[model samples]
Target: MVTYFEATLAQLSVHRVGNKGLNEFYSLSDNTLRIEDETLRRLLMQYFLSPFEKAYEVFRFTHSSDDLNLNELFHFSSMIFDDQSAFHNLSGQITKHLFNISNHPKIKSGELYIATFRDIQLEGELVDAIGIFKSETKESYLKVNPEEGGFALSYEEDAINITKLDKGCLIFNSEKEEGYKVIVIDQTNRTDAAYWKDEFLQLKIRNDSFNKTNITLGVCKDFITNKIDEDFEISKADKIDLLNKSMKYFKEKGSFNLDEFSEEVIGNPKAIESFKNFSREYNEEFDAGLDQPFDISGAAVKKQAKVFKSILKLDKNFHIYIHGNKDLIEKGFDEDKSMNFYKVYFKEEQ
Candidate 1:
């Protein structure tokens, strides 16, 4: 009765590489993943289609401050929660936000938000937590912050609170003069995180401002000022050749692990072959569209990668056992209606 996330987490262990560390396991929760014996940290980056430009940035998010890589953080927190390690705490505030998201109808692929609930207190007496979330289609319902902290809401009067998390992000809580300070995050561009405002609409950060203009030529501009800059880069012919050559690292050293990591992640060798074949074919097509020595990946490439991620499976024989074999389901499986259990047929020995 192990959930995919639980099973996947059990397989992953924190493996460090000098300064940064990569998650050496499959993240069945968000997406499929694999890492074993090879320079696994590097292998996953390519396998997951984590772009080279954002590589270091994403890498840092895993092992930024100290030795506790992302996996270690999960391993540590999982122990605290009776072995239910579902989320990594972004901060006290971010953790609360994640809690709210643990239950949802549909959080669109690109859709993300941060919200707050002011003057909300839980004395353990209330049947439900304070705060209301009203989606346009459905009536508003009372909810609680998953973790703790952040401005999730602006009551007619006090407190700001945020709930729900999409990725690894920090929620800020600054102190004000009178009682408390203001709470807001700029997410106009993709680099910035998004937050829900009174359940109305979230703001988007403008790419123009975050990108082109800000460069860390002299000093580091952080992710905000350099958002656009991070998204694009200009490379000469030699570097392009190096990248194409470097990619072999994933495919080459990746082979020793072929029998294990890649095999498990892809499930069937045929599927793995298909993925590799397509990667090469599409890589050529993608490169064909680029200009001169400089090149960038278009949305098309990332889209295909997502498609591959979904269909890729680690267990060929894996089955989703609902009420398995409890009853004989006639003509089998339909998600809409629940019928009966399934039965397996076998041949008698002659």
Candidate 2:
């Protein structure tokens, strides 16, 4: 549970943007370029406040001389600026645009805060990180008067509401096998989730075994819902029971054997064959494979659980849990012809 500070950006100072650099002071030249491009500005806002969100794990920054990633980043920024040398380049680029934001009609004032972590514990590992956040706040005042004609407006600083996180970015110093991982958040209009994820952070979307398993499970659910199971002449409960068995199989076994799973869960020869064909079609359609051993991800299983429902909701009265013993259940209409009923037979009431 890390806490953050919020204060008015009264002035732009070099001290706020780290001390070691050729450029140390905020000057008129810094105001030469404004953040006019909507896409770039939106990304900046997103990157600035991303670390504060709970979904992401934070880390501490390990900045010093001869940091390669930092150097590469500086080079990247310099290329963007088309400059040979950029002292205090990252902050300069960010702050100048921030200064120009005051001129925009929609944005009047903003809050800029710097975040430095001593160390961050993430997934049982501690790492260094740095973050910056810019939030747009709506400021107002309350008028109070003790005497007549002596009313004074008190600036409601405490009530200042954060309308949105205009821009933010957080950088971690921990070295991954490929590169440093970063998080960026944007609330602006022009860009989407992919723009920040792909273009700015250069993050590779996870398409691993866990993701593939989720997709395959989702395909099975689709097959059941779309009446592809009708060819097996199985009842609705039977269809759900088969799906539940499939889930249980994945949970219990390390590697999924397609033939074995089809035999055990689906049972019927026609249904098993249909399931195999469906699995093949799913693999080919989504660029995934199901033949190999893929360790199931607990997270993926939990996420897909809601989608793989095994309950039959009958009107508003009964929720039939149809995960087992489909043969004991019978579905038909009553003699009145206005009511549908499912007669369930159980050995004992547990």
Quote each prediction's TM-score: 0.18, 0.53
Cα lDDT of model 1 overall? 0.25
Report the Cα RMSD per candidate: 24.4, 10.9
Candidate 2, TM-score vs. the true structure? 0.53
State in Å the error of residue 49, model 2. Answer: 9.8
lDDT to native, each model = 0.25, 0.53
Best by lDDT: 2
Worst lDDT run of 10 residues, candidate 2, spans: 7-16
Give per-residue CA lDDT, model 1, range 80-154, as digits (tens).
333323222212223333334332223222212212212221111111111112111112344444446543542
User: Which portions of model 2 show Cα errors greater than 4 Å?
Assistant: 1-88, 91-118, 129-203, 207-213, 227-235, 281-290, 348-350
Q: What is the per-residue lDDT of model 2 for residues 254-277, given as tens digits with 9 covering 90 to 100?
A: 766678777787777877788788
Ten residues in sequence with the least summed lDDT for candidate 1: 1-10
